[model samples]
Target: MNALMLAVALATHATPVSLEDARARSRDNVQALTAALQASSAEQDVRASRSSLLPQVRFSAGASLNYIGPQRSYNVVPVEGGGFQQLQIDTPEVRYPFFNLGVTVSQLLYDRAVWARLEQSGAQLEALRGEATEQQDTSELEGINRFYSLFRTQATIQVLEANVRRSEQQLERARALFQAGRVGKAEELSALVNLGNDRIAVVSRQSQLATDQARLSTWLAMPGAEAVEAVDPGVLTQAPAPAPSLEQALQEARTRRPLLVALRQRLRVAELQESIANAGYLPRFSLDAGYQRTGPEPSVFFGQPARQNRVNGGLSISWDLFNGFSTQAQARRAEYQSRVAELNLQQSERELEGSVRQSLVALQAQIVSAELAEANRKAAADALVLAEERFNAGVSSTLEVRDAQLKLTQAELTLLENRINVEIARFTLMRAMGTLAPGEAK
Candidate 1:
């Protein structure tokens, strides 16, 4: 109740919104924003992987204190030619501080594994982007659905309110007739009961409208105190175009569907992973070089700067040869995953075909339903007018007029619902074909 009051207060000063505005508001939606952020993170992964293919350089420096113990030696020279004198020598203890600095650079001369990993990262990034697009599309479609629902519910509430007013008028007329002895009390009572029923229907419809508005608020990312008033949008009255052939739709879905594209990229990533694992069986070559200075203090090699100054470089090869069959197992697992990706891609394609077909069929059915509902509404309106006239002429009772009004109210509501359904179905078809987006249909 509090939320409803707050919404009503906020809505009082708000302008009505259209379907396009609803779709645009979805750009700020939490789901869409989160997906976009994830895509950006994936792009960074691509950059990091590319960096691995470049040369690496690092610097190191260290300092330490050392202690040296005394050294003692004793020697006897073969008895010193039969007059051997034993000689003993002892060296004093010493301590020194040592510091050194070095820089090392390494570059990959040949490594198929690193190259494959770079490719795999690129494929994974592509898949992430596709998934992000799918999230965006899904969020937009949900917003559209909620907007239409709120609009339809609001319209129904208006119809119920109008019905209640008509019932009240009929009750007044019945009361006048009973007082004049032209009608009995039962007729007036029946009219009063109907007015009560219409009032109850109005209350029920108002509750439903409130619920629908709350749901739309969430999709629009509005605060609880803010309410959205979705106007007619004008799309409800527009007729849908003819659906494309089934085979054409299937082809388009296979090519355009985000999930299918993402899965295909995943399959490529898995294949690259397999290549990377197999690369372990081959020798890797690299070039590494370093410069070092050793002295009493930290210094690079300059003239008379250090006791030892050295520049070293080497070209090295590494071969795992055998490592407990780990490489073989990894390759096997990647192969299995590759198969899984392939199956996933195929499954998405099949489902897309089915979804597209089903939506098209449903769209046609809704179009027909809307036409029939419009016709029914017109017929009910004519009957209501004729029954009202007959009652006024004393040729019919209030019951006939009441039944006609009820039928007309129900028919009007049905027409509104059917129109909204047709629009929803058309959008659903577009979504299934991977073409649903803001401003596209409009």
Candidate 2:
């Protein structure tokens, strides 16, 4: 199929579109913005993690009315008049109202676990950034592919339209010649058939172009995007150099894949988690201090009364010797998680190797295909010129000319396809090798 047919087949029923609009729409679309927000969320997570390590303070204050139930009787104090007589006692409820206020503060002291976790959070943040970048890369890559695809479809549509016009002109000439008795009924009939075939081809290609446009618009996230015209592929070109060496590409992937980096970050976090869990076995310490004043202190309604003042402070320590195996179970789970992270990192490395090899192989295939298409295109052009010359000289039939023309058009389309595919393959190789950035060129 010609480029337009390919595009139309790919698109929803629609007209053509311009390349610039498609890219612009994609950049401004929901997908791009969503990926950006995801990165920001990861950064916020890191900030929260860092904040966890900072000193925290809490204030406490409350007022209460207490109906002090019955005071304790004084132990035996002998009265001088009664000598050893039993002392009389009175028990009465005491009522008092007071307010208490204080502030408590705690600062992180020596916590190896905390330091490890902080570092882990930092790594995790970086990993998230990488993932967002990867997402952008995927979008951009798909955009490039769809963009060129649209170009091919537009080219094919042009070819089909031209062919239909040519066929109509041929049919008109044949009818005129027949009316003048310069051509036979067979010639007129053949021209009519050719015209019908060309019209059918034109209709099919047009339909296909519509489909390609719709698909492209959807990909660009421009739901309302209309038909756009594509520019002619001015000239064919090749990558500036042979594909980078396989070893070089593999190394790049090892360091570049966001998924791998994310796994590595998790591994670090798991190490930190394990450390934090182990810290449960160690003692923790805190300090508290306070001051208070009690007894009647010159109330607004009462004469000045004696008051008692007091101050107190203390250090506290805590340790958990054993749980019902809960802490131990948690520690074991963390260990298993750490192991999983390590395994993932290893798997990523292996896949990176395979990707590099596969990309190189695919790149080679495109190069060969492009070369073959180039040679075939030249041959088809020559054949087409010969067929047209023969027809104009009245030495060949219209059927022969049309067949040659079809072959020529098909060859050119194939060549166009090969060129675009080569570019796509190179782009893929760059991604596989990890050399391509995750975003548009700066």
Candidate 3:
């Protein structure tokens, strides 16, 4: 039956999508893309923070006009010649246009606050990366859910159509028996009613399938109008794996979940923030150097002999003595925020453990249900066959056959639903354990 269904599905779909394919396409989901952009922005922030520790270079040029008053001469008496003499000594030029060009470089030698901020930015970058992974995993899980929903609806439609065909045959048989005087008009009417109900069910399932297909298409970042066909994941045909212990699942979740990891990184960032606030009590050190050239004209600014060259270097230190208690307030705020982060981490861990337990229990129950549903389906099929034989032998009424057929159809749908539920539960468990991402071990 599985093989037949697979063959029919392949023949009908021009391109059927698999679970892995759906997960792969989830990278294009809006949330995933947004997370990626956020991570990229955080990376730039880290670079900006680190740049404060590196050398900064700048170039400057300017020109200005100058003015000075006229020079005055002094009269002096010579000791040997008893006569007054006017003495005019050489004087430096006082009126000139000035042109200056300079290059300056500055580097931070020591700054505790700057260093702490750099570390905080690095932690933020890591936290954002983990968040991006978490978003990608979430998107992939959503894609998986949509794929299975579409697959289940498609399979249910097939079962309903088959039931309709069976009803048609029953209707024909009843008509023949009535003409032969073996059965009354009531049997024919009942068979007709059954056929109508089956057709109605098929139509309902078809509508659901269309909705599911569109949902999957939109999630996979395809055109909204495009139809998506899902290939069966074949979970029913395979043997179920042993369930993991709740403790083991919790351990894995604690170590592997991106959300938890991101939270831990945020805690580190908060601690670094506290450090940065406390660093206000420490002095900062830096190095600065510059070379300048001045001339009376723009052309001579770059000339060798006409330019007055200057080279200077210095070390700087700055310490904040007081800021109206702002630093103390900031430190207190940072300490409280760090405590909040710690509390959040604790709460998240508890929630994660609860999720793991619930998922594991649900998965185990679904697996058992799938097994029982398969057995029920087989029994229903056998019962339907017996009822049809009895009806042909004239020992049973068409109503008996119709009831058996309905039971079989219902059993088939139940089995299909249980099988799909088992798969969904397993994926949910994997997600809880943070192993749902593509290429991760399940």
Candidate 4:
């Protein structure tokens, strides 16, 4: 309730707020920092993957029961007294218990395309980092835009309310004149109708202002938030130097823009994938070691007997003989993907160039528009004063006075909106060139 009351109060006494302040408040938001964290985590994954190139060792120790059904041959050649002529018969299988221990070591020796994949992983990691950075910037830019929009709405609503008051005062004055037999009754009725219409406008604008405030709250993720206060959105002015040149903007984008960096990194990853695929046919080498021990105890060899340990170690190599051209096909596919990535990169470059140039052009136009709005607002103010003076002296009709008032009101609102639009336009240019400033994160 207190916040709402404060918001209502701001409707009447809003103060000037600088663009820098709004951006700073938005940056302090927590959401922005969360995005940065997500990016850092993704980069960590890439680092882990890259570390796979290092050698790895594993130790295995376990015990298992092994048994075959016991088997016996009736006609066995005995060393002492053998009966070769005896009928031969075989019993069931044999059973044994054994324990094994081994250690395994594997190293990523050079082969087809593993390096390429590692490089690709690095690129992917970089891309994700860039994505996070871009999101942070984009989120803040949106907040700034909403801030300005909210300010404009608040200002316009105030102007409309003022119009309503002015109309009411005029109606009162016209009624007095009519009662004195100085003006026709029709004039008073016209004033009454105008006042009603102005009041209606005030209500409509206030409704719009509420809607804008709700949207701003949602964007800023304000917790249990109240309606937005009307910010002053201070003077409408252009950056001192207007927009930077196209070349400079593009250069900045190349170095500073996250999306651009991400795209470039993705392309590099694709190239690495191509390399990895081509290397798929290469041979791979690995080392292994283990130990084995066997006891002469046939009783021990049976499932009920005790077991012994074993250790063994060896080096092994496997070279693929053929895969029916599968590897070749995969390499070709990777090559095609690499080409596509390169094309996309080129497209990004061209689009960025146009975007930067277009923003610069719009910024220049707003400068002119802002100056014109200022001059028009001043002229309208002067016109209203003169018309009011003439009507008081009985040298003008009510129609002239009303028209002058309407024109002046329109001019004032126009000037305020124009100021906001110009500010938004400057920020738009900043965003286009990937130069939005940092703000507080919640």
List where candidate 1 sits over 4 angstroms from the true fold: 1-17, 65-95, 175-185, 297-307, 438-442
User: What are the per-residue Cα lDDT tens digits for candidate 3 across 7-111?
Assistant: 354335435789889988986699999999999999999999999999999999998999876666676857555866777765555877888889999999999
Q: For residue 62, give model 2's deviation from the true position in Å.
A: 4.3
Off by over 4 Å in 3: 1-15, 63-97, 438-442
- Give each model's clash number: 1, 14, 0, 34
Global lDDT of each model?
A: 0.82, 0.68, 0.86, 0.70
Model 4: residues with Cα > 4 Å off, grouped in runs: 1-41, 64-75, 78-83, 86-98, 175-181, 223-225, 236-241, 291-309, 438-442
| Model 4 poorest ten-residue lDDT run | 9-18
Model 1, residue 273: distance off in Å is 1.5
**Highest lDDT among the candidates is held by which one?**
3
- How close is every model to the real structure, measured as TM-score? 0.87, 0.77, 0.88, 0.81
Tell me the RMSD of model 4 versus the true structure. 5.4
Better of 3 and 4 by lDDT: 3
lDDT of 2: 0.68
Cα shift from native, residue 306, model 2 (Å): 14
| lDDT measured at residue 364 in model 2 versus the true structure, 0 to 100 | 82
